[model samples]
Target: MRRLASGPDILLLAAVWIVDVAVFSTLLNRSDSPSGLLRAPVVVGYAAVGAAALLLRRSHPVWVFAAVWLHSCAANLLPLGVHPTAGVLVALYTVTASRGEAVGALAMVAGFVPLGLTVAAEVRAAAADERITILTANAIFFTVVGLLVWGLGRWVRANREHARELERRRLAEADAAVAVERRRIARELHDIVAHAVTVMVLQAGGAQQILGTDAARALRTLRQIEDLGREAMGELRRLLLVLRPSAGDEAQQPVDGHQPGLDDVDRLVGTFREASLPVRLGVCGAARRMDRSTDLTAYRVVQEALTNVMKHAGPGTRTRVELNWADALSIRVTDDGGSPPRRASAPSAGHGLLGLQERVDVVGGTLTAGPTRDGGFEVNAALPVPTTEPDRARSGG
Candidate 1:
């Protein structure tokens, strides 16, 4: 079962109870009047009851405040020489902290009512005018003290609410980041699987067609297929390591320690050529290295474009892959639509194109893909190049 009151609550109750009893008892002893002796036991009993009610303040703040406030007012009417308002103040703090500012203000005002009435009665019964001044002074004192306690409670409540809002926002951001990462992983897997399967299927068909007529060529095609399959498996394993790494693997690099980037574009083109796609590679400017992300994006752009060519346009299509390295890297892959017409596959969700667009946007680059004026498809991407320190200095000069 959950505990209603915590350790700190019990400690606070004990502290308040002790102070109230001690103050009430000391005031009673200082009084030489017979009325103080006669009402001493009653005062002690009242303090005990107020303390008991305070134990439930956290669970039932409003009711406890009412009980303690009324008890304090009644006890003040006696000749105990002091207002036994310790419990009432404690209850008021609890009410404000739990119920909120508006309710706390109302409770504070409600508490002052009976208190004001008691003070007014005492003022009227005073024999001298100066005695009325003392009563008013005491009333003002207690009122100021109550406001301070209530304000403290309001401050505490404000801080608590602020902390809760911060935690909620943090959790929301974490969930959004996780969703973005999942989409990113999905895109990577799609590029790998789609490109690999397309090449392998085409190679298998070509090998079968040439097996009896050209055994040597067929053997080469079969070997290329085996190599592509292994590369695809390796990339898949790298992704798995990223998704679920063991304790020992956490600090280690990816399975191959190298991700496919611009440097691997040559090898990429070779794979498609072996699969029987007539692809031409061209570079128009001085080649330079790029940041890893931009490099990977460039490679994927070329890869997905070629994969789509083979999948939609079938083999024997003449494809051109060009790279222009100037102020920025420009990649263009265009296919002149050719033989076997186009295969009628199931409708595509277009995840490849969409994922490529998102990736280009992340790298502060632009990408466009559509059919050309001729009966062919084209994909163009411009990736920004980061300026080296020497270039920056030269430009500054």
Candidate 2:
């Protein structure tokens, strides 16, 4: 069944039919030819059928075009005293807009042929006094009008396709950004949990061994384990809170009310000290403040390096963390002990290192990790310290 026309479609159909009736009535009434007067009803009926086809032009453009084209040819062949109807023009525009240039070009040719033929017939029947002038003017007028309608329809189709292409590209870019952010969050979560758990395990092992011989020291180790667990939980909460959409004032403060930075290195080293891993922190050149991202990257690099030392190098390993502040901030974590046996269930050796490399790359830095010449392992990174014009002015250098 044909779907019902909308209010706008109905209005359009009524308007086109009214215009066709008015134009045909005026033309037929003014004509002196008996044959034209006799064909008046036939012309009106064909015009009405063509006007009704306009209702479905947008939904079924090709069918509407076919119907209107046939009507136009019939009206022309009958030699009715009428011009190209409004319905024919509407159908031509719909076809070009819906079907592209190739089909549009064909419709234009098919539509204009009958119009040209009717004009030629009219020109031949006219008195010889003004035949050439009338033929030239009418031919120019009709051709220009037809081309304009067809061009306008093609332009609308091109614009619509351009807009759709832009929308598709925008959606693709948004999806890519989301995937990158998720990967970053995953790296952070892995680093936080893995490092904290490694420390807790070492502390727990120490506490178990010395529980009877030195109850106080073992108790201290147990307390350190508890602290590490709390810290990890706080960091995880903060990270998760950062993922949520912020509302007003709640988003400004860190969820755990702490932002880890280079200053936290001493406290971080203290935990490993308690676990009996001697971590010596060495600072070279003057220390200066860094932006939060670079600062966090620096801290995470050390944290992951030390965690690896604890996991692979085992206890009693002498680890060194050196920070060199210059045009760039350099971090070096080294352990003198060679690689020890890692547990079968431990994470792959490359996972943590790969995560660290990604973090460094994000901050436009470089990282290198391998066995050192002294039969040990080392992880080193150089992170650039961003300096703005304000800093240069403040320092007066």
lDDT of each: 0.72, 0.73
lDDT string, candidate 2, 1-397, tens digits: 8676888888878777766666533355655677767766766676677788787788889998998888767766665655446677778888999897899999998878766865676677678988998799879977888899899899998999999999898666554444444355444554666678899999999999999999999999999999888767755654553353322211122367355778788888889989999889888766665545556779889988999888777788888999887788899998886345333333344556765675576557899987765667788999977452323111100
Clashing pairs in 2: none
Model 1 residue runs over 4 Å out of place are: 4-7, 22-35, 74-83, 117-127, 213-397
Off by over 4 Å in 2: 1-5, 24-41, 79-84, 213-397
TM-score of each: 0.52, 0.52
Q: Give the alpha carbon lDDT tens digit for every residue of 1-397 in model 1.
A: 7676788877877777676767644344544677766666766666777787888887899999998887777766665544556777788888988887789999888877655755665565566866768697868877788789889889888888999999898666554444454355444655665677799999999999999999999999999999878767755654553353222111112365356887777788889999999899887766675554566779889988998888778788999998887788899999876664332332132446665676676567899987765667788999988554312110000
Q: After superposition, how far is residue 228 of candidate 2 from its true place, in Å?
A: 7.5
TM-score computed on alpha carbons, candidate 2: 0.52
